[model samples]
Target: MRLMLVEDDDHVAAALTAVLSRHGFAVTHCRSGAEALQAMLPDDRAPFDVVLLDLGLPDTDGFEVCGRIRKVSTTPVIMVTARSDVRSRIHGLNLGADDYVVKPYDTGELLARIHAVARRTTPGTPDPADPVPGSDVLRLGAVTVELTTRQVNVGGAAVPLTRKEFDLLALLAGRPGVVFRREQIISEVWRTSWEGTGRTLEVHVASLRAKLRTPALIETVRGVGYRLVPPAAA
Candidate 1:
């Protein structure tokens, strides 16, 4: 598979090139963010299956690079970074990145992640409970959801959502206009390890409305959690 390798360091790039090449992948390595952007938008460069992006770049930060790419592309991205913070990884994931790998990683694990990330790029398989024409997949106007893959698309364009965002949408979309209490959603969707406040659910809901391109679908019941119906696309 053709993969875009965007990293600023020479040694890391070289090592990745050799390792990835040995795995039968055609790697197009770019050192600078400018070069990476240019390569992605090249008139002749066909879309690569996946991007292995480093967070640190000489020309520009990879986070900004990723944000720019999301404005036009849905090609899967697996971010490679030296930052060990979970929040940083979560931020990248929120910006539409499919996965995150830290520095000093294993080549085999990276390749495995790439392969797993590839399978998720296209999710059409049906689950037992979904309705026909993707009823098993959730449908709310412009939003078409793949419950199995946890991917959400608005107006046929994929939306960059974190795992929690996807879960919140799935729960609400399952029952249109059902007012779930914040605690209920937290208990049901999050199960355990919910470190944020009741307001955190609101934060996620607010974020969903902002990114969803529609504010009417998820309605607030005043002291209730949230509800979902077909998005008012018009």
Candidate 2:
């Protein structure tokens, strides 16, 4: 994967670049938010697949940089910061960050998150070599989920969902009426275990229900998990 890593600390950047390179990632190291933003500008070069951003920068705050990036590109941005507070994480995500990774993190977990975000941003297509079953667009009553474009619609009205919210909805919609365990949902959607990430799943579910304007669409199975009931079925 091609990545733009924005971190002011030379030593830290160098270490991360080396590690990511060893894992077959093409990484461009930027010393500040300005440098990172400049690199992200339209150019002949192909756009980076993902951005690893640090909140602390010399020229600008990482949150501001994230907002700027979102205006130009939909490339997944993962906030790599030392801030571990939940508020910081929510703030970064609200600013359009695809994922938030607190410092002192497991390298394996970070790698997993990078792949997860990439999967969400990258469109999936049926292979010509091997026959793959399943349609790209999932229709459930009036709600339509165009998997290839990541667009959600309800009764012909577009529903704007965050990356995580869309992921969650798509997961449940994939198997309507099936109760997906909370742990399973977190693993599949958030790419994290059901530990500190449970609250995130809850928040996304609530948001999806609200945005879809169908509280009954996603039925909460008491003492279990959640299930998707098509509007028609409901």
Candidate 3:
């Protein structure tokens, strides 16, 4: 895979580059946000498969770089930073980052996250074990979910949802009243395990509720997971 490592610390970047190289990745290390952005431009060079971005850079903030990258390209970006707070994670996701890996992470886990995001963005890659919906459209009272287009609407008005938010909502709407365990949801939607991803799932659910304008649409099952409360049931 062609991967971009945007980290300013030479020691950190060199160690990570060596690890990535051993894994058969063509690693391009950029020490600053500007350099990373310049390299990301569409050129004769092979397009990057994934980006591992560090939040602290010499030239600019990582979040700004992520937003800029989104405006120019659709390549998957995974923010590797020390900010483990839920707010930072949510902000990164909101800015179009494909994943957020807190610092002091397991190298194996980081590799898995890289492949997961790359796989999701690859052309013709199927969603993780999504059930075959009877129809392309799924309707739950006032909300309408178009599975094929990945679009959602409420009361005939369009509602924009982040990619993860849509996936979470679709999973729940797929089986209304069927409580999906947290592990199951994470595995199916994010294609990752439960550890370190629970908070992300929570953020997605909260975003979905807010964007859908139906706070009661998704119900939390204490000590379990969550379920979709059909509008009629709500």
**Would you list the C-alpha lDDT of every candidate in the order shown?**
0.76, 0.82, 0.85
Worst 10 residues of 2 by lDDT: 124-133
Stretch of 10 with least lDDT, candidate 1: 125-134
Better of 1 and 3 by lDDT: 3
Best by lDDT: 3
- TM-scores for all candidates? 0.52, 0.54, 0.54
lDDT (10s digit) by residue, model 1, range 1-234: 679999888888898887676444689999988888888885766678789999889878899889888777877888999997989999999998999999888664676577678767845422211234435687788888888778889999999899888888887776555455565577656774335667778888999999998888888867434667555532
lDDT string, candidate 3, 30-93, tens digits? 9999999999888998899999999999999999999999999999999999999999999999
> How does candidate 3 score on lDDT?
0.85
* Candidate 1 Cα lDDT to native: 0.76
Weakest 10 consecutive residues of candidate 3 by summed lDDT: 124-133
Ranked by TM-score, the better of candidates 1 and 3 is 3
RMSD (CA, Å), each prediction: 16.6, 14.0, 14.4
- Would you list the clashing residue pairs of candidate 1? 130-136, 131-135, 131-136
